[model samples]
Target: MPRTAAPPRTADLQARPYKPGDKVVAVVDLPGVPEGTTGRIAVADGLTWRRYWVRFDNGEMLGHVDQHALVRARDWDAFRHARELERAEAERAAETSAEADTDAGGATAVAAGGATVNGVAVPAHLLARSKAARERLGA
Candidate 1:
């Protein structure tokens, strides 16, 4: 048997604290990015420096942002609280609408081939699709 040489090692991989879906804020402007822009971590690579990809609030996707270039989003706690409030509001609205629909003598109203519950005009099918999308995105 012939001896084989070992493959050359590249950069050492390190584990990053942030993961996909984590909210982050840009600490330094790079190229088109400006400081203070909020974004979400789309991809995180621990193998190389500046290997993360960020999708900014303005719809710009930038890659290779180093860990030091970003920080956890400012007001992260407030953002979470706001989302919780929104979720609660949506739930309450849905409940109230259902109650109203039931109070209308159990009459099922259909408009343009879509069922109407309360005064909300959105189609049931569309609402289901939107709910599915939100669940998939973990939003």
Candidate 2:
């Protein structure tokens, strides 16, 4: 009997991180893109290009962007505060779960404290802070 290989998972989730409701900034325009601004990123993804997507706050329009051209996205203060709150909540959960498995708390903490960038572990707080600070400054 021949052995079968697993299917490849080609998700671009490794590219950029954006929540369904989060606002983003557009960095560039690809003529190949459908119809959106070059330098400006719209918040919603409804009007986005190939792999790039964003939706504005008012929920008016969705922009399509090229996944490759997406150089940067604006991270704001509100997003920071929200993350801090999220971390606190996660820590609390870890504490509770620690009783079931002591090792679990440490593992959770380690995972929560950092995020992966191109498969490299980077401090989540730092990324959050920089984006938040830049957003605050923009406002």
Who wins the lDDT comparison? 1
Query: Where does candidate 1 stray beyond 4 Å?
Result: 1-16, 48-50, 75-139
Q: Give candidate 2's error at residue 15 in angstroms.
A: 19
Error of 1 at 49 (Å): 2.7
- TM-score for predicted model 2 compared with the true structure: 0.26
| Sliding window of 10 residues with minimal summed lDDT for model 2 | 6-15
Predicted candidate 2, C-alpha RMSD: 19.9
For candidate 2, the per-residue lDDT at 6 reads: 41
**lDDT for each residue of candidate 1 in 1-139, tens digit (9 for 90 to 100):** 9999643211111123678998887766876788778899999887555568999998889987887777677544444455466678789999998788665423433444445545545565787798899999999
Q: How high is the lDDT of residue 72 in model 2?
A: 33
Deviation in angstroms for 134 in model 2?
64
Error of 2 at 9 (Å): 29
* C-alpha lDDT of all candidate models, in order: 0.68, 0.47
Best by TM-score: 1
